[model samples]
Target: MGNNQPTEKSVSDTISDAFQPILETPILNIISEIFQPNLEIIPKYSEPPNYNKEVTNVYILKLTDDKYYVGKSNDPSQRYLDHATESGSAWTRKYKPLEIEKVIKNASHFDEDKCVKEYMSLYGIDNVRGGTYSSVRLTNAQKGLLTQEIRGAKDCCFRCGRDNHFADKCYAKTNVHGENLPPKKKIVQSRININELELLSSETSSD
Candidate 1:
């Protein structure tokens, strides 16, 4: 009886231990797989955001003669297109197909408005505005004429009264007679020396 009891007890205890190990092995594996300290599980969100701002600058375009169109813009290329396509203002509409001569950026920073105003005042009011007729269009001749007129009005020169001629040919000069007269004295120092030498030689030969 004691021997049978010992065998049954040992078998029952062995089976119970085996069942516990089977159940606990899977649970342990699941817990380890799910709750273990994983370094790669959390997603990283480390990317930079984007931002930008508008910018302001100056632009210039060349016109006929010495004239130009000065303007301001956030984008110079866009502003240039706007002027040509009549997109923004009446000025562009009136002056279609404006030829861009040059572009001057940051003109506001350089006091461009003051410079343009001064240029207009010196060149004449009409110089800033384009003429109505093709004949009146700003030309190289018209530019020269305007420059002459401006200089004449200022009484800048006595010769041409405009900047074309010099002071030597000045019609306003009072020394007209002096201008055509010959030089005061001839340079005869070399001639005098030669003559003295010849006379000394002739005297020595006679003696």
Candidate 2:
């Protein structure tokens, strides 16, 4: 008697058999005819990534629109993936980075500072943010400047340019009296006599 056995199908054969009928069916043709082509074209995939992707501390992100975010991370690729998944920095998620614009070779935060400053200058301060040391320094500097501005306005008289009192309580309310002798006493006065009026009202009510 001759030996006989059934041959096993290959993976290619199995897959072909499964999809061959679907490919040959007229339903695809019917569907194609029934529906108009989609108006939106699928964008081509991004170019091949840099193979030498070392985790440099600083990276720039190009927003989907007109904005930028400079950042630092040990694993920039993973950080990017986090951004894509919406679990990364709130800025990156909100703006939606189109791509990692550039990865700095240096891990120094000073370099990050330079990048952040450049982006802020180019795109306007409102449009850019991030970096480790840069963020802190910028924030501190901004806060300091704002505080100084506030204090300067409060500590000097706009009318007389005196450092003793505010403009609202200045002796020379409207006069640009040039820098002269400082006021001997604090100008503890207001345009409205609220306390006197309130005192009069209280006395009248009591009477």
Candidate 3:
């Protein structure tokens, strides 16, 4: 009788057999997913970006009316979008079909204002509206000087020559006589006399 012993499979074949399901399962799952009916794909939505607040930029936009508008905003792209989509400003609304022509980033607010004003001058004062371009925005010092000029009035202070303060409040007037002092304090004796007459009349009426 011939000795018959079953030969064991190679170690490599066993290892391959063990890993076959592991490798093939994923591929089969992928194929099933592809061929599956009514497959709903979950949309991959990215998170919205944070808005940049410190984007001081000057922008120039051209309108359908063949006019260019110079303006400033923190975000020029968003501002342009607003001018295009949002029907807010009358100028933009009337003009319509607006497009951004130029952008100057990282500009000072004052410089932006100056640029807009210069553009307004070049275009026409009536064509521009709002912002410092329409009115001069003065600094605190400039405002103070303006206040002084207004207070100076027609008659100027001879002492300091500063118009902001009245002559009575003037430092030079402090030493001056009656003219410098606010009109003398007058005691209204008439009121007291009227009160006495009223009391006397009431008393007489009671008698």
lDDT of 2 by residue, 45-84 (tens): 8988664463357888888768788877777888888878
Candidate 3 Cα lDDT to native:
0.61
* Alpha carbon deviation, residue 128, candidate 3 (Å): 2.9
The best-first sequence of candidates by TM-score reads: 2, 3, 1
Error of 3 at 115 (Å): 1.5
Whole-model lDDT, candidate 1?
0.53
Cα misplacement distance, residue 28 of candidate 2 (Å): 99
Compare candidates 2 and 3 on TM-score and give the better one.
2
Tens-place lDDT per residue, model 1, 69-186, is 5566667788778767768444445555456545554444444454444354454534453212123346776655654554555555433343555545455433222334333334
- Cα deviation in Å at residue 115, candidate 2? 1.4
Of 1 and 2, the candidate ahead on lDDT is 2
The Cα RMSD in angstroms, rounded to one decimal, for candidate 2 relative to the true structure is: 22.7
TM-score result, candidate 3: 0.36
For model 3, where is the 10-residue window of minimal lDDT? 173-182
TM-score of each: 0.31, 0.38, 0.36
